[model samples]
Target: MFRFAVLLLALLFAAPAATQSLQAQYEAFLEGTIWPQAKLAGVSRKTFDGAMGAKRLNTDIPGLVTPGAKEPPRRMRQAEFSAPAKYFNERNIGYITATGRSLARKYASTLASIEKTYGVPARILLAIWGRESGFGRVDIPHDAFQVLGTKAFMSTRPELFRRELINALVIVQLGHASPSAMRSSWAGAMGQPQFLPSSYLQYAVDFDGNGHPDIWNSVPDTLASIAAYLKASGWVPGRDWGFEVTVPASVSCALEGPDRGKRISDWAKLGIRRVSGKPFPEHEARAEGFLLMPAGRHGPAFIATPNFYVIKEYNESDLYALFVGHAGDRIQWGDSRFSAGWDRTDSMLRSDIAKMQRALEGKGYDVGGADGLPGFKTRRSIGDWQEKNGRTPTCWPSNALISAIR
Candidate 1:
């Protein structure tokens, strides 16, 4: 009976022992696996040791699992999708636009120079700057090496983070920042621009001519680095991101993607008109535009340009692009809200949406990989499916449709 009690106690404490074993394995991975990659990437032993030697695993980072754990139950279903209306809280948008205007005046010459050099406008840069880190006012408070190394060692995408960790070491070796000074977000996005180290290496620039791309502190470097990223991603010079428009029902929301673009003039002919009652800019009229109904017919719509997609390259979310573009417009053109009101759509779990998407795919409709978020493909597929079932197509996801599609 005493032996049985001891065995029970040992089993009860086995979990902590397993966790300790995993942490040791992660440390070994750093020394053996990460070291070679960093060394091959030209990170010196001194810099590597300085940055990585004392770093402990940050157990607090999201999405971590035990080294030998079973495939975890899907937790994505527990996450509730927020309404787009919630994303555009008036107070938040107001703060971003208000701050953007002030920064625009304060950095007029620098912004003008950046626009001239990169062809990305000052308003766009200001909006991004405001969005990324409150134009550098927000204190990013994690050590880059600690966050990157921990993520690289134990994250869902370890290989990707391993590369990023090596890149971060390269940044340190280049003398751009000391290891101690290399602050980052918990997710390892660094500086005012919130660039991952690889992105920093690719796009960060020495705009202030201070011998370093000081995105951590220099306003010129932060704004210019953002412009450089947009330009590199093929932002169209002098072209607008997109225009808020009243998309006619006759013009199907299925037409909303980079792959399916038509001349703005052609869309105008199709009864798509700008909500402001102004004509599509004469130059833009001849250019291609894609329909962008983020919430399908359930919310505001847009006629997104190639430049609109470029904004998306910064952060892939449609709402993110819309927020940046709209905030920029507010700074440049003054306050104006979306013409159509965002409907109070049904809340859903991303997993349920993924299930709907898979069901749609099985029926020969493309829902863009069952990744949960409704892109143009998913939205159109939903609409097409609704029409097939003899229902009026809203071209958006709904709680009722979750069961209906399945």
Candidate 2:
């Protein structure tokens, strides 16, 4: 009985059946899928073969599973939604701002030229430069072809990575970058600006007139590329990203999201005032401003502009855009922090949040696909639910709320 039990255990844990091993699978994918795409993208056989011939798959990249393995559970139970306050740690922000100031002076001429050409502010470009790669001090360690190819062959989003892989080959074929020079992040974002290959192809600029947008080693190219990307993403010139504001109790925190935009003047009439005691710029008064309460009413709030949303196009996270804007303010104006404080809220596992989101969605509330993260949709839905249940709306998630909802 013991021997039979041991055999059953071994069988249960055994690897899935496959005609080809992982390495063989990777090689087959390269030849069958990758080569055809590369050819279609106009990459010569020499460049494609040279770049991919001996490259081995980096199977250890995060968010990967075996090709034929059972899909993992949708909810990441162990994932903790990090505290909003922690995202704006003074030490980290200070380091970025301080380093940004130094680089601002060091590359003043380059930045000035980039700003003139792209209509993006030097401070904003410098902030993104510092934030993305620590002003190129941080080393990008993976080979572009290797990272993208590996991800394409087996990662969760294979199609996306496959497209990126083809674009990388296109970059090489165009002689924009040699394969050896194409270092990237584990997720396959490349160079100082950390753009994916498609973005690189579209936005990278040869600022120094070197005939190639060498974002890897050229300061001018790196800064210019970032500016080009922002410019392409519709960064409004002469407009501020956002201003930290005090949202009066009368204004519902549930009124948060890009879709809920109103004129800056209208927002002011509703008693939302800048924390700095300054009025909204005359030009922006008639322009649309969206309420961005990242942590609902529990944390700092802002009246964000279209330009603010443009920054989010660089990175989807609200915190990320705020960090860039705040860091730029520090470098350009002076050291400043958000006037409002982030209140402590009860922590809950992302799985629980997802459960709450699904329940709300089933009730015809849009919590935005029941993802673990409590985005604007989730936050507002929570408030709407609260108001409907005769509870005061907090517009934020909490453990108590989860229990109540469940």
Candidate 3:
């Protein structure tokens, strides 16, 4: 019986590779299936192979790509949103702002043209440039083909990866970029603007009129490409990213996100006030927005607009969206004060946060139904509990709190 069990375990371990085949088969497929797609797309096979041969499947990276498997969200706050609001003050703002302004100057002409053409704000573009690549300080390491191939070979979304892998090969064949030059993020985001191969094909532009949309090496092309993507994703010029505001003493707002836009007048009528203490502009009085009290009622709050949602398309997570917004906000103005209150403390791990969400829901507080995220309701409950128990209000969760509520 023990021998049989050993054999069963061996087979279980071997079964996945048996199902997917090894890297050799993957290589042959690249030569066979992928090359044909490239030829049809006007790429030479020699160029395809030579450009791609520099790198190999990064088995480690594919671990980051599988979908529907149990893994953390790509980004999460290191602590409760309230904890950092105080530290994200004028001194830090000064440091980040200087960096942003310098990057803006470096990309000024390209930025101006991109803004004129795409309706994305220049400061926002500069902020992204500064943040993602450190104003081009960082160098890309892995060739994109290997990165894409590794993900394709191991991804839960095999169809998506396969398509992207083929697209990378096709780009090589088109002479748009060599395999060696296609180095980028391990997840296969490439170039100055950090575009996916598919996105590069779709939205990247040759702003210099240099005949190639050279995002990898050309500054103008990359900024323009970034701008183009933002425009397509619904960036509105001249509007602030959104305002940090305090919710009114009376209105019961719930589960509103940047995705849920409500007119500013309507939100104001409900008692939302700006953090800066001045009234919201009349022109934007009717611009729809959703209330997001990030640290609960005791923490900081914001009214995120459609443009806020646009930044999320650039990156999916709320924290990433906040980073982009706050970075831009800091660049535009110095040391903006907190809009809402916070009971600052360390954050729960994402998995813990998920468990806490379940606990909170069972206790009759709605925490947006536990998709492994902390949001308004979850934060609010933490705040309410802390307020009631003299714990000084924090958005983070604890197993002890769960035990108490139970």
Candidate 4:
């Protein structure tokens, strides 16, 4: 009993000592590593000290790699890659669309001026705004210094976060925003548009003309900054993002990717038609359009334009761009759902998908690194494998496909 009591007491004392040691290392890192980089980035010593002095390591943030640990950080828990339907939940979409429409009217003149200057549509800006932070209604509760500093000190992607930490310091030095006023998401995305500190420096705009870009409070600044980012990302003026279309069985689902673009007129020749029963605009006929099948053959497909890929620059996900575009459509037009429904499919673990991707890779197929998410490359590889095996191409992962691949 005496030995057990002494051992427990030792552990209790040792825990605090270990924590203090880590804290000391973190302070050293900030002074030796981060300070030099921030100095090189033109951040003043006062600004750097003011922003980072009291910051401590935030262990609660996701995907953190503990310093001096043997094993890597555990993969952050994510929602199951199930039906794509859940992504387009009616309640969430309805709320964003309804709120976006009201804001569109409220900022009509300001949006028009932004569109004239940036050449991105008002609806698109409003949709991205509504999606990003609920049009600045959502609380961004993390201090920029704490989140960035912790990630830079020790995280899965330390180098990337280190660069951003310096950028955050520069933002403070340039009088763009003070450290106290700079709130961010746990992932370090800041303001209404969820831009990183680097993106803020590169793309954020002072549309409200307040002598500085205040993305946190100024509505005009937030919207115009989104527009400016999209514009810089090669948003083509006078072109729609995409159209929901009916892809016939004759056309291969593997034909879906930004690189496989063809003139809209040529896709129409292959029996693709808009689900809305409207003709492809004559002006767009000559422009390039890529096939987009987010769910392979199991859900609605789209004829995406270059602008669709441009939207992906803000947040690199097919579903994210689709949600922004679809919500924008609802805000401008009316609340109508996708013409085709998402077919219910088997739920599989990401590990299962990764296993199947490895099998494909063993067979000389590029499944895009087997990261578990079915990107365009994975989807097309599935389609090609199905075709090779004398099966109809679904282009999506399934239990049967996983079994058959191996």
| Highest-TM-score candidate | 4
Model 3's TM-score against the true structure: 0.78
lDDT (tens digit, per residue) of candidate 2 on 76-129: 432125487777788878988998889888888888888888899988888888
Residue 262 CA displacement from its true place in model 1, Å = 0.5
Per-model TM values vs. the true structure: 0.95, 0.93, 0.78, 0.97
lDDT of 3 by residue, 1-406 (tens): 9999999999998988754565666677677766677677776768776855544556677354333455435445454332546545556556667888776776777778888999888778766765667656678877778878767656666667778877777777677876778888887888878888889888989899988899878878877888889888988877777788877656544435554567899888888888778898887786777777655544567888778778878876565666677877767665554545456455545666667678767767777777555665666666666566676554445556555654
TM-score of 2: 0.93
Off by over 4 Å in 4: 68-80
Can you give the lDDT of residue 199 in candidate 1? 91
Cα lDDT tens digits for candidate 1, 85-163: 8878789889999989988888899999999999999988888888889889999989989888887776777777888
Candidate lDDT values, in order: 0.87, 0.87, 0.70, 0.91
The predictions' CA RMSDs to the true structure, in order, are: 2.0, 2.9, 5.8, 1.6
- Sorting all predicted structures by TM-score, with the top scorer first, yields 4, 1, 2, 3
Worst lDDT run of 10 residues, candidate 1, spans 73-82
- Each prediction's number of clashing residue pairs: 0, 0, 7, 0
| Greater-TM-score candidate between 1 and 2 | 1
RMSD of 1: 2.0
Instruction: List candidate 1 stretches off by more than 4 Å.
Output: 1-16, 68-81
Using lDDT as the measure, which candidate wins? Answer: 4
